[model samples]
Target: MKSLKLDYLKSLKWADYLFFALVEPRRLSGKIADAASKPLGGGIAIALCAVFSDILAASLLAVNTRFFYYKITYGFLLLSIIAFVKVLVTAGLIDMLCQFMGYPGAVRTMIVLILYSLFPQMFLLPLAYVFKVISFAPPFFYVLFSIALFVWSALIVITGISETHSVPFSKASLMFIFPYAFITLTGFLASLLALASVFGYFASI
Candidate 1:
């Protein structure tokens, strides 16, 4: 058990993977692939990091609030809702699929890859909107950056999936597709709830 535990520890590198997620994504891919055949916590750690990053970005973007405390509190609450919903739906649904296909623990690899694949988005919004890093830059530049981040995230996701499993590309793409479909379903449900609340409020009045 000690030897196995030590090997698991060797496969896990939450900090290093997070850092290289952007600069050295190919290197990050190797780390993820290495963990595929091992029972490691790297994926779980990275997923949690992504959640924290979302909350941070939301809080930072709330800078317009006159008071720092309320800004952070409300921002974290707002982003937490979205992040948890996405995370839960993605993990649950994908894990189910993986299990169906005889890749049960592949969820660990999936979550890490998904988080790092989305690192660009999670990293960029805070820098651009919150810190005002590229505030002086032209609007077109921001748009271009967003596009690049999205494309890069997509490419990295594909590579990560390919490395983690021997599953065909078509099956692997389902991992991406399911999360997006869940997001759309979630949004639709939210809108319906909002509409119902609005109507109920007017009826009560």
Candidate 2:
């Protein structure tokens, strides 16, 4: 049987291209130029990484909450499941945007790009939380981290979309807004429904 790592490497080596995803996103455009030909392993890797990232973040927050720090309330398993579902929903939302915009990209391509772009948030969350615990940090520190993470993720996605779709940067930015809003709304509604279900279950019990 062929290995997933070998499968991923068939498209692009993770060790090398991950740097491009970090410092030079434009480099990934050519690597995935033909989405149909690219190995699905890349997308799988991103999804798994994203799920584990969320779980790791949840674990760190679980410990930090006890220290009177970031108060996250989900257990690792729940958070991991939520992360998996979230990636699917967000990828679907991006596909919707692509359909509306008449962009000629596959849904798989969108999913891969979106998750790849979010790689930084996955890697940084634990470090940021640990750093804050090690030293007293002001609100500004978190604000800065949030902004940096947003810009970093946004730029990578925007760059990917622009280069892959041949869309102009300004238009790409506008195109991204719809999926972003959809993702945010989807998460919000999911949260409210979950809360309502919990309350209803409590009332029944």
Candidate 3:
């Protein structure tokens, strides 16, 4: 009976370890560890980092175009820089957020959650362009850029989640996709309304 009790205690301890392992900073650290062990995984992480950088660049371009009225050529250059920085920052943030979530690691388990939360805007960019609502940059570039962003986010999430959760890529991919779609829809609608208000204000002027 005492042996049985000891075994149960051991099992409980293992379960606790596994549960906390899935949570945050530790999870990110685990991914880093896995990547170090596997060359292919390291390569994937690098690619994912680049993708995130591009998304950041595109987002910066959009904002600059809207508020600063920067020339297109200059805006593109700025976007490129932003994208590079974004990937670096995002990776770090993922690490931090993971730690906050009780997971520690460089693998970035929440990358999927972030991407899934943001990707829907890709669909909205074209519609916003077609409507001729805003005088900002071209719609096609934004949409294309957004696609790249989505891809990066998806990759990061997939790699991170698979490493941290020991889940298959196929399953984690779904978690990235659906939530992003919903968030994108919400953001698109909000953008449409804001654009409409801007147009109305301009016409009144």
In order, candidate lDDTs are 0.62, 0.65, 0.48
Q: Relative to the unseen true structure, what is the Cα RMSD of model 2?
A: 6.2
Candidate 3 scores a C-alpha RMSD against the true structure in Å of: 16.1
Q: For residue 165, what is the lDDT in candidate 3?
A: 56
Which pairs clash in model 2?
none
TM-score for each of the candidates: 0.57, 0.66, 0.33
Candidate 1 whole-model C-alpha lDDT, 0 to 1:
0.62
Best by TM-score: 2
- Give the candidates in order of lDDT, highest first: 2, 1, 3
Error of 1 at 146 (Å): 4.3
Writing each residue's lDDT as its tens digit, candidate 1 over 91-201 gives 567767667667746665655666666666655555555334555553444456567777877766765665566566677677657767877998999999999999999
**Model 1 stretches with alpha carbons more than 4 Å out:** 1-15, 23-30, 33-63, 101-105, 125-147, 168-171, 182-205
Q: What is the lDDT of residue 139 in candidate 2?
A: 39
Model 3 quality (TM-score): 0.33
lDDT of 3 by residue, 92-126 (tens): 55455445556545434343233232333334444
Q: What's the distance in Å from true for residue 20, model 3?
A: 25
Lowest lDDT 10-mer window, candidate 2? 67-76
What tens-digit string does per-residue lDDT give for candidate 2 at 1-205?
4696569667666654467678887776556665446534555566566556554544553444453222233454465566556666665775677777787746666566766776676555665566667754623454566578768888887787778778898877776676668668888999999999999999999
Best by lDDT: 2
